[model samples]
Target: MRRNTRRRPTGARRRTFAAVALILGGGGLVAANTYASAGEGDSGGRVQDQSGGDQAATISCPDVGQQLTDVPGEARADVDKALANLDQQITEAYDRLTSTRQEQAQDGNFVRNSILGPLSEKRTEVIGQIKIDVKRAGGTAPEALDGLAACTEISPAQAQKNDGGGDGDNQDGDADTANPGTGQDDGGQGGEQQDGNGNGAAGPFAADFVDITKVQPNVKAKPRRTGDASTGTFSVQCGVNENKVFNTDNLIVAPGVDNGAHHTHDYVGNQGVDAFASNGDLANAKTSCSEQGDKSSYYWPVLRLQDGTKEFDAEQQGGGLEGNVGKILQAKEAEITYIGSPAGKVVAMPKFLRIITGDAKAFTNGTANANANWSCTGFEDKVQLADKYPICPQGSSVVRSFAFQSCWDGQNIDSANHRAHVAFADAEGNCGNGFKAIPQLTMRLVYDVPAPVIENGQVKNPYAVDGFPEQLHKPITDHDDFINVMDEDLMDEVVECVNAGRQCGAGAGEQPQEPQQPEEPKQPEEPQEPQEPQQPEEPQEPKQPEQPQEPKQPEQPQEPKEPKDKPAPQAPQEPQDEPELAPEASSADADKDRAKKPGEAPDAPSEASSAPSDAATRTQEAGAPDDARGGETKARTTSPAETSDTGVEAQSEETQPQPQAGTGSLASTGADLWPAAAGGVLVLGGLVLLIHNRRRNMTTN
Candidate 1:
């Protein structure tokens, strides 16, 4: 009943499930932090590794993937171009889904919306299959698509773009867009803001600010496949604003177990999700913590960083990302413009937000830090049982004792110059053990996309340009918007079924002839008075009576003319809450109702069987013995036999009334509309693939 309320999700839900990705201050950690990114590569492939230290020996697990973190990105886009194309397509789809509303308001994301109808679920499955298709093509298994892959190596130009320097309205501060492929500014890169590139990093700024239009993912297919596979351009965005993620799953280790150099080896790729560990490994931390399906921060250190830069020591506890950050305070020169960073992963999956407190130094905190692990998430914080922001995430921890070691290093240590602030804990509660920690800010940290598509078999990459937040928002909008249209199409089918039942079946007409009234029981002529015994006496006197017999008023009063004027009015019937007649019933009439059932046309020749099906049946039945055909004859129309119920077959074209063909103009317009999304998918993929591969030798440097 709600007017067109049912619709496909536009990935606006990602905003709702919004987890801020904060690219925090960079630095190194001690013993405990070093062990997080440990994966060893081996031929058997089941090979896994760990930080080669006492820490590695302490933590024990059966399988390697189990030891890895399940980050957000399952939807795969291996090369930079692939990532860009996917980003463009997703954003475009969203624009169609929520052209009229915004994410924070009405729209939901792919995962949530897909649950609404059949196609939604199917959409999710198709994407998963695509990942398999690409993997089967001999590509390296991708890092999880959802969130696991962290950014690394931003181009100088890309870094400047983050500073908010650009020309255009994006620099003016308007993030929301009704136009396809854009979104309203949410205070980050989505609004009017200076472009965050080159010298533009910090000019007038807008969160919705991004300029991906230069890439133009809104494309079409060519009449024929060009050898290079180039079809159309795909607009691309550079930052979080432009990335409208969807059904992100966990890109996994089906990739077989790996065993490779560890401890002192430079990681080949984003070591964040390696499936193997070195011979020695640090135990993944486990606390009584739970979040959006993730439990235990067992692989915390590795899952958080995508730089292929592994630097943590799981052995000493208070010395990993958090701890090293504390140390950076003392070791690094101060920047008046602190460019304070936020915790991006924590910001994205609200479920991961949590609160924790421990001593500022490995020496002071290690004693109690082992058990001091604490956590809380966005929702828990919202209702306020805890004291953190609803936007933060939750996680477990590994302290000094995790490696089965007890460093009673004399308590008076601030070697890291760390001081904790109540803000560091979670969306819930917080405690300051003296570590000056600022939630990191969200920013673009890397650029590498998927491979370009092949035309008639050659390669062409399309997503050549990158955009900022303002630029990114529109794409997300477009992505969702298109999906919404798809949702509408699905609903139209439901209405079609309902109409068929009402228009072509028995329900379309009056109930079969009201039961014919039972014939009034014939009454014995008012019982002839028993011939009185007088008849006996009369026999003897017959001779004398000859004269008067005719005159005797027939003793029986002439049966008074039966009264023709009165018959009890049929008792007024009670009101029945009648169902409204169907739209087609207006044509039904008594003449039609009397026809014989479809296919029951008597053995008579066509000319003689002139009566309609209903008429023939009713008339023929009426011709039966009078005792059986006592009801009054009446004409009524019956509905045509519907194939589902009566064996009646579909009528030939000649017998069917023609539906007005859609106008030529309307038909043409619809035809074009149908190809937009499909064509866009392929075009964007080809273009993005080429551009992404341009950067990779695909050979390890």
Candidate 2:
């Protein structure tokens, strides 16, 4: 359902409308007094109505980022001109269609013929010329051009028939013939009748605009479950960084309808997000998330708290507030759950899968509010009444949870109805019979707001919020949208990691360029020096005792003799060299090759390797600052400076004074062996002499 009609400018007509308004109003009022053009003035570059006194603005063309980039540079100029002209035509057509009463704007038949049909023709002509120009420019026309059409499309309504008279599964389908109004007209009628008795309606929320009870009984009856309890299911606790989130003034719902819905939305994740954003746009966007590989776009309407105390500015009219809205604060965190069945087997999400949850158009309209979700941070199980938007207490936050349809029909990434090709998963998060499991998406948004107090036994000064639809004026109209633009490789990793029950953090491990070695390598030097000193001490102490006990120093000789096994000494040298090479090897494969060569010792490489890990440990203990991980990773990479340090340590070891005990033991072992050999020869000579003398004496007898 659409809002009641007033003159609103389409996109290109925005400038003209402002100029005309200034002329008609005699320029006596300030710039804020004139009506804003569609898509011209809104927070976050998104067009939505503000409640106040001015006529609603309209949007003109799709954002340039949303356009097809398949057009060659030579044909780009031609396409741009055609698109601009098409935008003009479409905006004019939207103006004509909306030139009726509020009720007429919602008529499916009226909008289809007057607005969508003409716009489609214009779009078709432009696309046809684009194709012709592509061929003319010596480029093959892309297949995307065939499927390309207007994003501003309208559909005929086919209201579902309820067997239980407005109950049962009647709310399942998009085609519903129910004519639901915000009852803005009825409130005035009732007030006029009560005027004579001096009982005028106190405020908008006090009258017919406040009946969310009849509108969303389903949400009040049962809150939807969103999280996956299964082990190995992945969840990303995306921190709230409001500075990175953007607000644009482009309306997403009705592309050319100026200020069709008046509000603002907060956008996170993808930086290049706009209504016309395509898969390419998302893929190319720089994300606010730590996971650079995740290019999915996330957005939701901004929340405003009202106390019925502020006057309206002219620019804030049409959908402007009747009460004072406080300063908007970004949510604290968004808890995102990527659910899959049978743990770790989450299928890679299809590219450009668009998901919308909650009803952005359900302001003050009961029929549109059926599936809305609202609750307090601490009171998740006790869902508040539909009409009552909770004001959180100090220290607590207002929580909004969203569960998107996850089951898919396998072929269509999208359908005529934004949701027809998708269905809800079972309680276990398994896909339904006809549909296969896609990633089950759920996000919980937490907000900080002051609590409303009870006055005269009723809650007062509550936080009220809504979506772009101007007809709806209740906080129950919260909604959000997401578009998946993950890189193919990253998507595969996500599926593998989740199916195998791995807990993957955001940005899906998309690492930045290799970093330079860390500056804090000195910290590791302290521990390494002590460890090296102990190794040399072990052999020196035992060798000192060998020189004193020559024969008994067989033990000492064995000790010196050990080095005689030159191969054994060489083996220890290689392993010692390996630790040095480990650092260089860790950084670059080329360095590893040099270290592996038998001729060169990798002592420097060893120190280089230890430097980074030690530095990382210290950094982690110090509570790794946001940029520390990058610094640590870079420091781990071998640097020329680290190599120089390794050489210095080697030179120091070679030049250091040799232990006296080690030198003496070497000399003593050699000296002892010569004496033992001479003594053995002397004893053999004496035995021979004695045997010859005895034979001579026997002959004289």
Candidate 3:
């Protein structure tokens, strides 16, 4: 009736309504996604609080020592004590922060009021004392030092970024994909339960580990060696802390302070090393090294399996009480090698020189000074991870390697920050800022333990390196300490050998001679055989009886000639055909001997030196730095010389390696923004269609 004259609801009107609905729906999705992205970006890379609020994951303070470059020698002791107190204050505050999580969840200001406020106050007092110490010692403390007293809280995400995402967890909630379960039983100490946040007494979140096989090869090529390069290598047979030489003290960092490291360290070289040990004590102490000449103290954080086993330090301050718990794992192999500079001749390390490589607080301090190198035995050639603990494949042992700084300032044996006195060489292997090249200490530690398991975002039978309470046992906090205690004669010999480009050390002499001994007889025989014929003719002319004696003399030489020709030629041929064949053969034989007698010396010098060539080849082929892991050759934010405000020369930026891109952060960003961007496009398209339909409807009307 009315429809006969009135216009019915047109298809254009229906299309207009559909387009409007599409625009509304797409706009809502884009807005929601934008809000979510903003929220995540604001999280500041911190571990999300399980109680549904954002809280600090760890405490961070300015490194006061890094700024005290010119503390007078007299003030160092007082300043050191004050600095150690600062660390203690932070440790106490961290304990409070972790223990009062419920309080933090209840009150937003709890961390600031109950934890950080008190910590800042304590640090301020300590900083004031440090200033007074320097002033009293006729040195000036920077007024800017006062500003360093205040500390702030950092999120795990921020820390991970600073560490270049070494912990293997992406901020985009992709940890489940990064770490997959192997269906293996939790094999170490059993019965340890993780809290809801994936932390326990000593933590290593499931995100802290990665399937090593999944990591891309990041080892760079070795620095090119020049004519002045020190190509020789000096290795020492340091038993793998077999005698249980473990301590939680850092002699170089916090002398005279107990529990200085707040974690256990496996010490191998010096027998009497502790926070209070004087240089004299180290020099006179017995050593774990096969050569008593190498009394240098070598120590690093001990690795432990979280299997519910109580260790000697379990109840001690630097152990379980400080959050370093679990069954300590002894390294199956500990290789300590001192290689010469690749740029110039290496001088002997100054006796009593203190060197601390890798920051012990790297998890909190950031990776500017972090020098951790982790990989598996079979995969070390392919990849090395700086931040993540590798879940090594079956039959592969976990490897932790450290390459100490090799460039030494001509003046200081030790600097206030410890790092200012030494620096790593450039990518081209040249030392900068007039720093002389010194023997580079490279350490390789292998642990034979069941691979840690992760399932449903939980880690089982987790293994972690010992570290500060706030550090959460992250692998990036792994570090090593060294104090040169080598006797003058031994040090001189090391320098001579390195300069001469000869392999010399605990096992160098024993193994190389065996390979060359089979070749030695061939040389003497060539000259002796010609002399033998002439001698026989002369003897025969002198007397017929003498002829018999001359024949006997020739026979003696001939006897060795027969056997030497037979096996000597064959032995030399085997070595020539495959240089590594002799060493592998010798290693196999040594392994048998070792298997037969378990109580015998764990590492024989011959066995240790047998594969020196092969090891050297691997070191070069893997593109590892001559001084440390090749992957650690990142650009330094602070120059070693610039760490001192005094007349120390500044290191040239051109000499430092450029920071590589992919090495900085591993979190995926572009892929995450795709869905949001796509929705935005859809919303725009819907708006365009709605406008077109509305215009058509208007025309029809």
Best by lDDT: 3
Across 1-701, the per-residue lDDT of candidate 1 in tens digits comes to 66886876544333222211110111122212233323222111111222211100000001111112221233222322233333323333323322322221222232134322332333344335544545565443334432222211111122112211211121101122111121111211211112111112111122112211111122111112112111111011111111001111111211111211011111111112122221111012111111111121121111111112112221211112111111000000000000111111011111122222211111111111211111111111011100000111112110010010011122311111111111222211111243222211111111112222222111122111111111221111110000001122222221222111111111122111111101111111113224222322421221231122223223212111111121321211111211121132222222123232111112211111011111111111111111111110100000111122111121122112111111112343344344444444444554454444443434422
- Model 3 RMSD in Å is 19.2
The positional error of residue 120 in candidate 3, measured at the CA in angstroms, is 0.7
Per-residue error (Å), model 3, residue 598? 32
Lowest-scoring 10 consecutive residues by lDDT in candidate 3?
Answer: 654-663
The candidate with the higher TM-score, 1 or 2, is 2
TM-score of each: 0.15, 0.42, 0.64
The models' CA-based lDDT, in order, is 0.18, 0.38, 0.60
Off by over 4 Å in 2: 1-231, 237-241, 244-252, 255-261, 307-326, 342-345, 363-370, 382-387, 391-395, 426-430, 454-460, 506-701
Error of 1 at 4 (Å): 81
Tell me the number of clashing residue pairs for each predicted model: 198, 51, 5
Candidate 3 residue-wise lDDT, 221-258, digit = tens: 45555545565557776666544455677778789877
Would you list the rank order by lDDT, best first? 3, 2, 1
Checking candidate 3 for backbone clashes, the offending pairs are 45-157, 46-155, 46-156, 189-307, 403-628
- Highest TM-score: give the candidate number: 3
